[model samples]
Target: MKQGLGTQLRHLIELLDGAVQQSYADAGLDYRPRYTPVMRALAGGQPHSVSQIAESAGISQPAATQTVALMLKEGWLVAQPGPTDARQKLLRLSAQGERLLPQLQACWRATSAAANSLDADLPYPLSETLAHAIAALEQRSFSQRIRDAKE
Candidate 1:
């Protein structure tokens, strides 16, 4: 019984994320790989709305909102009412998050180096493979492929 592509992809992500989380813990920093994008977005010192963060981070709005909520609870983020839109809230890194930046940046550099080493060990680079996969999916989505297969 062979595993499906989606399952394999998910397993790979889990494996990588687990390693990353452990590395952060080892460095005395509590962070999740999922938080990287949102943190990066706020690192520029500009406050952003959920939608802006979603677009900048290439994540869904709901995901950004959820991440923001968790970060707020964790004291990693601070939110203020949007100046123009009273209903919208602008988000920025909290003081605690700022304090963690140096350690996080070190981890990021190490992660990049590790990824490069891993890519060198593989026949095809993971980043390139993912880019190609995304392009192929954009050309013909998996949903369309499944429908075509049923014909």
Candidate 2:
């Protein structure tokens, strides 16, 4: 019995994330792979709202909010009242996050190199495949497929 596409995709993500998390640990950094996007978005030293972070990081607002919460708990992020919109909280990296930037950048470079190598080993590069799949989904979403199937 073969696994479903979703199961295989999820398993692959878990494997890759686990490997990267272990690498971060080995480098004495207590960082999660999922935090990378938010960190990168804040690395520019400009304060951004959760919505901005989500767009810049190509993630969902809920995911960005969750990551922001986790980062705040870890002291990696700080939120200040938005200059123009007092109601909106603008998020930025804390001093600790700034200090960790160098180490994080090093890890990012190594991880990118490793991913490139992995891609070279594969017949079709994972990145390109994922991009194409995303594009295809955008053209015809899974929800539409289910709706079509029901009829």
Candidate 3:
């Protein structure tokens, strides 16, 4: 039986993330690919709120919050109360995270090269396809499409 679109997409993510995770493990780094976006969002060494990280990282707010919590637990990030709004927290990379940047950046470069190689094998680049799909969805959400299909 063929997999559904959602299942296929999830499997694709599993394949990509699994390889990256293994590479990090092989490099003796305690890191997750999911954390990369957050790290990048804070790479400038400036503290940012969860919403800011979410927007910068192109992830949802909940995902940013969860990743931030995990990074904080691992000592990869530190958080302080917002200067103006004490109720909000601002987060930044910890010393440990800063020390890991050189290695992480190298890994990111290698990952990008690998992705480009993969894209070369395909007629259409996966990155561009994804971007186009996202744009289409933004113009008309999947839910709206589904409703239209029922009509």
Candidate 4:
């Protein structure tokens, strides 16, 4: 049986994420690839709320919240009460997280180089394809396409 587009996309993600995760392990870094965006968002040394992290990371708020929780548990991040809203928490990198930044940045560079090489091997660059797809989706969502097909 042939796999659908969603299945294929998921398989691709598994392959990519697995390789990156392995690289992090090989580098003796106790980090998840999922944590990269959040780390980058907080790299400036300014504390930010979950909503700010989500916006800075270009991810959903729920994703930011979940990642922040994981990071806090791992001792990679610390949270303090928001200045005005006690219910809101501002997050920043812990000392351990700060110490890990250089290594993480190096890994990121290596990953980018690997990605560039992979893109060169492909006829259509995956980054460009993803950007194009996102742009199209912004104009007309997959749900709209499905409705049109149904009609």
Task: Looking at model 3, report the run of 10 residues with the lowest lDDT sum.
Answer: 22-31
Candidate 3: which pairs clash? none
CA RMSD, predictions in order:
0.8, 0.9, 0.9, 0.9
Q: How far off is residue 139 in model 1, in Å? A: 1.6
Which 10 consecutive positions of candidate 1 have the poorest summed lDDT? Answer: 28-37
Question: What is the alpha-carbon lDDT for the whole of candidate 3?
Answer: 0.95
> Of 1 and 2, which scores higher on lDDT?
2
lDDT digits (tens) for residues 15-132 of candidate 1? 9999999999999987888899999899999999999999999999999999999999999999999998889999999999999988998999999999999999999999999999
Give each model's whole-structure lDDT: 0.94, 0.96, 0.95, 0.96
Off by over 4 Å in 4: none
lDDT of 2: 0.96
User: For residues 45-144, could you state the per-residue lDDT of candidate 2 as single tens digits?
Assistant: 9999999999999999999999999999999999999888899999999999999999999999999999999999999999899899999999999899
